[model samples]
Each structure stands twice: as C-alpha cells, then as structure tokens.
Target: PHQKTVIDVEKDILYQNDMLAQRNRGYFDAKNVLAINLVSSPGSGKTSLLERTLTDLKGEMEFAVIEGDQQTTNDADRIHATGTKATQINTGKGCHLDADMVANALKGLKPKENSVLFIENVGNLVCPAMFDLGEKERVVIISVTEGDDKPLKYPDMFHSSTLCIINKTDLLPYVPFDIEKVKLNAKRINHQLEIIELSCTSGEGLPLWYSWLKSKVLAPEPV
Candidate 1:
C-alpha cells in the first residue's frame, strides 16, 4: 500500500519471519542468487511469465523456481517440464507464502552457482506482499482481464514491487485496457516503479520483458 500504515505492519513481521528472511536472503546472496518473488492473482499468467523467462534465459544464467500454491504441485510440474529445476510449496490453509516456507523449500535443492531464483507466490495479491521471502526484488504481474485499475486497488502489491508486469497484451484488442492509463495509475502510486507489458501467448512485446530481465539478472555485475 502507498500508505505509511502499510510500512508499519511490514516492519513488524514476526521475529521468526525476520530471522528466516535474513537467513534466506543471506544464503541467496552468498551464492550470488538473484531471487525474484512473483506475485499476482490466479490466471494472471504467472506461470507463463516464468516459462518465457526460463526459455529465454536458460543458457545465459542458471534458473530455478519455487512454486507456491494452496494445494497442488501443478505449477512446479510445469516448470520441470520446461527442463528447469523447481520446488513445490503447498501452503495448505495459507493464502500467501512466508519466509519459513521458502527456507524449507530450498532445503533439498542442489546448489547452483550464480543462480537466479524465482519464487512464484500463491495466487493472491494481498497477503503475499506482507511477507519477505529473501528476494532481491519483488515483482507483481497484472493482466488486462484483471482490469487496468488494479494498481490503485491493490496498492500494497504495487508498492512492494520492484517491477510491474502487464501480461496478455494481445487480448487488448478485445479488452478495454489502457496501457498508458495503467502505467500512469501505477506510477502515481509508486513513482519509481518499472513496467513491462507483453502477451505470453502470442509473444507480442515479449522482447521488452526479456531485455528488462537481462538488464537486471544477466547484466555484468559491478566490475
């Protein structure tokens, strides 16, 4: 959320949560891991975004995923089907993923040097933004079908995000979504937000996403 009250709550996450988040982030940093927490509602194309990213970045950098869901391993299976490593975190009764769950999920993973880890949060826009999973960046994905006003409606998700993705741009022709308006609304909430809008099915504007990702995760580290 853009409100100061939001920070008040985030700053006071449980001690266990803070400890684990720090530990996990430290583990990631020690391995040169760039962890990205991907958050959005179900059907917002979170998996599609991951699929596209892994396909384009596999050769350039080590990639893996932690799929969070309320009950199944479906998302993880899809990630594995793409020939990349993946872990499944079933939250059972929980709607969002927390650091402890993430730390537990990574326990069985074989160490990948210089890896880029992607944590796909349980499909929700609210609770997920409250917990930190030791990610270097938090990314939120929204689609036209979900509405262009999503940023203002879910300001917490947008405010916590390091980048915002507008998926399913190809559907724009049949939808009433406005790219400029969405960007404007998102920026009004978080003026420094970075955005990328693209269609997962048709690949329209996908290059922009890939390029943006490369600049963040694949670009040469400070020399």
Candidate 2:
C-alpha cells in the first residue's frame, strides 16, 4: 500500500506538470518564440555559452533569459550584464524548474515575438530531466573535465535532450576525456541526438552552434 501511494503521488505530480507544460507550449507557439532549455551539471559552462551567444548575436536577434538556480541570482546577473532581458528563479529546496515556475516567469520576461528565450535550468542532470518547461528544444551540455561515461550514467537526461553540447574542448589536451566515446555513448542513449563540440573560451566551433540556432529559428512553423 505504501509503495502504491508513493507511485500514485508521483504520477499525479507529473500529470499536473504536463498539463501546464502544454499551456506553456501553446504560449510559445502563439508568440512564435523559440524557447530552449539548457541543462547540465555544475561548472558545465552553460552560463559561459549563453554569455558568448548573447554577446556575439546581440543586435541581430532579440533574446530573453530565465536563470534557474537553487540559491543565488548569479547566472541571471551574468545574463543581464549582456544587455538582454533576464529573470531569475531561485528554486530553494527544489531541484528543478517546473512548468508553473516558468509560466510565472514568462509573465515578466515578455520575450519579443520571434525572439529566442533561453531557460538555464539548475545545474542538475537528474531532476531537471523530468521537468518540461515547454521549451522547443532541450540542450544538454557537458564539459571535457567531466567523464565521458556521463551519458551512460545519466541516461534519462541524454535520452530527453534534443542536442548535446560538448563544451570546454580546449582542455582536451589536458583531460583524459574521450570525445568519440562520449558521442557513441550519447548516440546509444538517443540516436537522434545532435552533438556539437565547442570551446567557449577559444571560440572553436561556435559558428556551427550559431548556425544551428539560426536554422531552428528560421525554420517554418509546422502546419
């Protein structure tokens, strides 16, 4: 009886979140906003990538950001420094940003039509995978310092993400990580997962990332 109750509670919680996620998806579709959820473990360079993207693409496209963290507003502050609109959501004891939190944040963000909205989820590979923030794309980022077996260890995250970014490639010479092995592992989890290897510090492979973003934004809406 106890196990059944726990499972029921979990299902109910997920059901509620899924309904709200559908609403969020509708909102984004109505506004033609391309919302992308950035997920990763701590120190994975998600913020660095966002800073670079915002700085390099400034003036070309309007962007808004929602920074999610368990404690401080540091990430939001960094995003704001780039002159882009950003709102911070401190989850406190919560591990992930749920659809309701994002729904509330969207009220203040008011991302422009046809603009890109980046929701930087809390640096967690586990809990965040289960929450859908109504994003058009979910990107998983991993740094070279992290082990190549991350995809296999965090299969849920790898299975859920649409794209996997291999960041901090500049440290490849110093780290023991294997790029090909990581790609294979990620592919094993999700064969359709698009992989992009880049070094935010060195600007390597950034253009490809930029092009991918452009392609998504420029793609015609589905009928």
Candidate 3:
C-alpha cells in the first residue's frame, strides 16, 4: 500500500509538471525563442561552454539565461558579466529546475523574440532528466574526466537528451576515457542522440557546436 501510494503521488507530480511545460512551450513558440536546457553532473564544464558560447556569439544574436543552482548565483553572475540578460534561480534543496520555476524566470528574463534562451539546470544527471522545463533541446554534457560509461550508468539522462556533448577533450590523452566507447554507449541508450566533442579551453570542435546551434535556430518551423 505504501509503495503504491508513493508511486501514485509521483505520477501526479509529473502530470502537473507536464501541463506546465506545455504552457512554457507555447510561450517560447509565441516569442520565437529557442530554449536549450543544459544538464550534466558537477564539473562537466557546462558553465565554461556557455561562457565561451555567449562571448563568441554575443554580436551575432541576442541571448538570455536562467542559471539554476542549489546555492549561490555564481553561474548567473558569470553570464551577466558577458553583457547578456540573465536571472538566477537558487533551488535550495531542489536538485532540478521544474517547469513552474522556469515559467517564473521567464517573466523576469523576458527574452527577446528570435533570441536563444539557455537554462543551465542544476548539475545533476538524474533528477533533471525527469523534469520537463519546456526546452526545445535538452543537451546532456559529460566531461572526459567523468569517464566513458556515464551513459550506461545514467541511462535515463542519456535516453532523454537530444544531444550529448563530450567536453574537456583536451585532457583525453591524460585520461583513461574512451571517446569511441562513450559514443557507442550513448548510442546504445539513445540511437537518435547527436554527439559533439569539444574542448572549451583549447577551442577545438567549437565551430561545429556553434553551427549546430545556428542551424537549429534557423531551421523552419513545421507547419
């Protein structure tokens, strides 16, 4: 009885979140915004990648950010330093950013039409996968230092993400991580997953990432 009750409550919570997510999607569509949710474990270089992306693309497009963290507003501060609009959402005990939190953030962010909105979810591979923040793309990042079996270990995140980024490739020589093995593992979990390997510090393979972003934003919407 206890297990059934807990399961029922979980389902109800997810149902509510999904409904809110739909509303967020509508808002993004109405504003012509491409929202991307960045998810990964701590130290996966998500922030670094965002910093590089914002700095490099600042003149090309407008950007807004919602930085999620369990504590400080450090990530949001970094984003604001780039001259982009950003708002911080401190989740406190929460491990993920839910749709409702994002909806509230949007009011404060007010991202311009035809702009990109990056929601940097709290660094956790598990919980973030279950919540739908109404993002157009869910990108899961894994640093080479975190090992090659991340997708196998956290199948839910890998299965849910649209893109898998292999970051910190500059350390590939020193680390025991296998790029091919990780790609294989990720493909096994989600064959449709698009993969990108890049090093933020060395600036290798970043152009492809930038091109991918532009293509997605520029792609015509389905009628």
Candidate 4:
C-alpha cells in the first residue's frame, strides 16, 4: 500500500509538471517571448552571466528573469539591481525549478514586446537537467573552478543544453582546469554544443558571447 501511494504521488507530480510546461510554452508562443533556462551547479556564475548580459543589452531588450533558489531572494535582489524585473521562486526543498514555479511567478509582471526571459534555475547540475520549464532555449554554465571533467561526470546537463558556457576564465590560471580537456569532454557528450568561454570579471570573450546571444534571441524558430 505504501509503495502504491508513493508511485501515485510521483505520477501526479509528473502530470502536473507536464500540464504546467504546456501552459507556459503556450504563453511564450502567444507573446513571441524568447525564454532561456540557465542551469548549472552552485557558484557556476549563472546570475553573474545574466548580470553581464543585462548590463550590455538592457536597452535593446525588455529583459526579465525568473530567479529560482531553494531559499532566499539573493539572486533576485542582484537582478533587480540591474533595473530588470526579476521574480524569485523559492522552491523550499526542491532541487530543481519546474514549469509550475515559473508560471506562478509570471503572475505579477507587466508584459512587454520582444521580451527576453532568462530563468536562472536553482544551482544544481542534476535535477534541473531533467525538468523542462517551457523555455525556447536552454543554456548550461560550467565554471573552470568546478573542474575540467564535469562534462564527463554530468553528461545529462551538457547533452541537453543548447548553449554551454565555460565561465571564470579569469580564474583559469589560478585553478588547474584544463580548458582543452573540458572542451574535448563536453564535445564528446554533445558535439553540437555551442560554447562561449568567457570571464565576467575581466570582460574577456564577452563580445563573442554578446553577439552570439543577440543573434540567438533574435533567431526565429523553423517551422
């Protein structure tokens, strides 16, 4: 009876997740919103990357963010500092951000044109890889400080991502992360991965990333 109950609960969660995903996706379709879900482990610089992006192109895009964290509104606070409307979703014990969390958070925001919605999922490389939050694109960020072999160890995240960013290149010298090895391993898992190696602190490689992002957000989906 206990096993049956557990199974039923899991099934319900999945059903709810699916329904929310469809709804959120439909919302984006109607508004022509280009949403991106950014996933990575803690300290992977997901928020920092978004900060840099916002600073550079806030004038061009009506940018907003859905900041997911297990606790606290710290990340949302940072994003709000940039003058972008950011909604914080505290997932209590949840390790990942699901579609419902995003849908719920979207309630209070004012809609805008050609909006770029960046959902910064809770810092966990595993669970976030499993849940699709109705994003048009998914971006995975891995920092050099996290080690070079993360791609091999966490293939699911790397494989599912449309864009892979290698952050903290400014700290590459201080750390023993082999940039070449990281690329090779990541490509092994996802040969088609679009990688942007950049350091937010030094502004290194930002131009390439900036251009790539502008093109991507503006790129229309093929029918």
TM per prediction = 0.90, 0.97, 0.97, 0.92
For every candidate in turn, the CA RMSD to the true structure comes to 4.2, 1.7, 1.8, 2.6
Clashing pairs in 1: 1-156
lDDT of 3 by residue, 1-223 (tens): 9999999999999999999999999999988999999999987998899999999998898889999999998999899888889999999999999999999999988998889999999999999999999999999999999989999999999999999999999999999998999999999999999999999999999998999899889443566
Worst 10 residues of 4 by lDDT: 214-223
TM-score of 3: 0.97
Predict model 2's lDDT versus the native.
0.95
Candidate 1 local lDDT, 84-193, one digit each (tens): 99999999999999999899888886447577888999999988877888898898999988888999998999998999989988889899888899999999989999
| Deviating ranges (above 4 Å) for candidate 1 | 1-13, 218-223
Instruction: Please provide, for model 2 over 1-223, each residue's C-alpha lDDT reduced to its tens digit, 9 standing for 90 to 100.
Output: 9999999999999999999999999999998999999999988999999999999999888899999999999999999999999999999999999999999999988998889999999999999999888999999999999999999999999999999999999999999999999999999999999999999999999999999999899444566
Model 4, 1-223: lDDT tens per residue? 9999999998898788888888998898777788899999998899999898898887877888999999999999999999998888999999999998888887776445468899999999998887889998899999989999999999999999998899999998799999999999999999999898999889899898888778866544555
TM-score, candidate 1, is: 0.90
Output the lDDT of residue 180, model 4.
Answer: 91
Pairs clashing within candidate 2: none
Ranking by lDDT: 2, 3, 4, 1
Candidate 4 ranges beyond 4 A from true positions: 1-12, 219-223
Clashes of each: 1, 0, 0, 0
Better of 2 and 4 by lDDT: 2
